[model samples]
Target: MSLFRKPQPITVIALRDAPDLVTSLRRALETATDAERPGLERALALTEDVAERPDAELRGRWVRRHLDAAGYEGPADSVNAIRVLRQAEPGLTLLQALTYARETAAAENTPL
Candidate 1:
């Protein structure tokens, strides 16, 4: 037998059906088109990459990177990011949702 491991396709669910963070973030980033990929695209991509692999330290790094890229520069902004992302409004792609988030953030003095 060989020592090398095999590759498996990451299981993906519909955005609406995503049960948790891995699936949810995957669907969120999936909505990001090639050009539309914003500041934290790599973090989004990295988080998805590690979902199957599941290294806690590695996952935390990327998750933090994602939060940082969303302009969550300080503690207050980060808190707002959490609130914005958790809203879960229907039928909007992550990018669209992000736009709404940014709009809302403007009023709150934060940037999503």
Candidate 2:
């Protein structure tokens, strides 16, 4: 058997189900300009990538990088990001949700 194996997918829930979270994301995205939005977009993409491989350690790494690039210092900042995204696109995916959570947790000054 091969020593390496594929990582498991990260299960994620829909943003619509989490109305409060959706609102939060929308607000966060609003603060940035179109040029600066790429960081948030990349963060969202990383979330989708991690969801496809939830168990992979790389997921966390990517999330942290994206969070920093997006100017999120902690959970509160992430909350703001989510709010911005939600306001921009109500139909955002679950991957976005997972990404937001991971970034928020990493950004948090205290242990979550």
Candidate 3:
């Protein structure tokens, strides 16, 4: 049996308070060969664009919007975020922060 199973769909949510962190995470995910890479890339681009906007509230709302679009519906707390990711993708073997974000987004049906 292969430990590396198919990647599940995921959603990624970031608060406006952490746009830079999210951008860096997206850059890292862009180099990933995992199935969630494409979505992450898309989310990254969206996040980047949102980050560039002038309004902070709008930026946060954009993050939430993307998360919703991606299918996540949890709060942006670190603990729940990790739980959401783990629950969504059992094959998700890595413990990296990006992986958590990706998995969390993919598993939930609402934005966090």
- Say which candidate scores most in TM-score: 3
In the range 8-54, model 3's lDDT, one tens digit per residue, is: 45333343654776768667896887887887778777777767754
Estimated TM-score per prediction?
A: 0.24, 0.29, 0.30
lDDT at position 5, candidate 3: 73
Per-candidate Cα lDDT values, in order, are 0.45, 0.51, 0.54
Better of 1 and 2 by lDDT: 2
- Evaluated against the true structure, the overall lDDT of model 1 is 0.45
Q: Look at candidate 3 and tell me the lDDT of residue 10.
A: 38
lDDT of 3 at 106: 46
lDDT value for candidate 2? Answer: 0.51
Better of 1 and 2 by TM-score: 2
Order the numbered candidates by TM-score, best leading: 3, 2, 1
Clashing pairs counted in every model: 0, 19, 11
